[model samples]
Target: MASENDYINYEMQKRTEPLLGVVIHNDASELNANEWREVLINAPEERYVQGIAHYYIDRNGQWQAIDTENIAWHTANQIGNEQYLGYEVLESLSSTDEEFLLNEQETFRVIASDMIDYNLEPNRDTVKLHLEFSETECPHRSFEIHTNWKTTVDGIPDEWVINDLKDYFISQIKQYMLN
Candidate 1:
């Protein structure tokens, strides 16, 4: 297994584009965070793209890894790779359990935090799925999971659904701060 220290020193190239927004992804691996880190350390250059997400949310809704400033190699087809921040919520074997819901909430919280930190808008245009840039089904499972949660949850206005799920999550963050 790669030590925590080994995963900290990635020599990412400086980004040419100004930070625009956030892109969410699912790692699609069965490995947990530590195992994923070890695989990333040992994987070939071609596999580095999988390791490109700036942040990774573990199964427990905890922030396992973060690299906010440096540009990661997450998005493919050269889309949004440099222009947006990226996060990967581990979904190798995720299910719609309480743990997954908590993890999803943490994912939203981190995205909200990044939105504040980067001065970006908190809407569909800014907070996006990897599929928006690529043809892949990345984060589709997670997205569907959250979409269902929205329909079932109370207090979230129906109008919020048209705006985008990020808006709902942002509202949740606001509510969390108030309480």
Candidate 2:
């Protein structure tokens, strides 16, 4: 059987388009290709050496699909993640239960294939995790990746959290400081 890493690489090598960059989150916010497989069954049928940079949601309550183009609030680096594509894996209250979605994994494979088909370069180098960029333990619980997700640099908020704590904090701080 084809391994997950192999599937990911194959998808990446296929993308020929030049893209902004790839954004990864330590939270369950990123989407793996396996979950996407449900939407596009034929993804496995295609052969790709690389994968696409996209976003996804966790299985906490219901599976919500995140937009790849829209910027997220997950800031690992200090800079704003305005140009990078974001991908989030799902996380639950339980660390042991945070299983990687097979569809998300498959979706990742197809995305990599799409990028290769378009002839583009991924955001930066590889996928990134929330904590890798900064000091916060985001993606919460068991949402952390074991590999390349560690590319996050220190003091880089280029990739920030979206519509979550980041926003909440900005709102709360603004309100509290104003009094």
Assess each prediction's global lDDT (C-alpha) against the native. 0.61, 0.37
Clashing pairs in 1: 29-92
RMSD of each: 5.8, 15.5
Superposed by TM-score, candidate 2 places the C-alpha of residue 47 at a distance from the truth, in angstroms, of 39
Candidate 1 — which residues are off by over 4 angstroms?
A: 1-9, 59-66, 148-166, 173-179
In model 2, which range of ten residues has the least summed lDDT? 6-15
For model 1, what is the error of residue 123's alpha carbon versus the real structure, in angstroms, after optimal superposition? 1.4
Q: How much is 12 displaced in model 1, in angstroms?
A: 1.4
